[model samples]
Target: MADEETKAELREQFTEAFEGADYPVSNPMDLVPALPDGPGTRFEAGDVSFTAMELSTKLSDIQDFPYDDVETLVDDLIVGLDEKDML
Candidate 1:
């Protein structure tokens, strides 16, 4: 299990990495982190949900993640993570 400090660092890196990108959605989903308490991180938009760690791995593995838009990025991330059973 990851320690609090490690999780915090990962969370920070994850947030910064995503926020740094250009989200096409005018009102992108809000990042709802479940840190220091809950299971993991999630992004909420209407009835949709996103897992941060899965997204992070998806991004980190890419030479440079192509999508600049959050909508597409999250959509692809979910599919990829799900296929890998990481979601």
Candidate 2:
């Protein structure tokens, strides 16, 4: 399992990734096509569609941190999606 520190780091990264104007203040789902495949699922934001795997990868690439806390990461991701109006 991932430690609390790892989970927190992921959360911070997620928040950063979803911030800013070019980041699509609305939803990207309405922009992109369909998702590939992975855990969680696919979501839409305005014009962008993001697969669970894609989102995970983006978060992973943001920081050098590691997290074995799948649940925590998933939960934070869901919240991030909603925050970005993708849910």
C-alpha TM-scores of all predictions = 0.34, 0.32
Report lDDT (CA) for all predictions. Answer: 0.43, 0.43
lDDT score, residue 87, model 1? 32
Tens-digit lDDT track for model 1 on 1-87?
334454344444444445544443232232333132122555443333445544555545532345555445545554554455443
lDDT of 2 by residue, 1-87 (tens): 334555455555444443322322223332122223324455444345665567656654332223333343346575555455443
Candidate 1 Cα errors over 4 Å, as ranges? 1-21, 24-54, 62-64
Inter-residue clash pairs, candidate 1: none
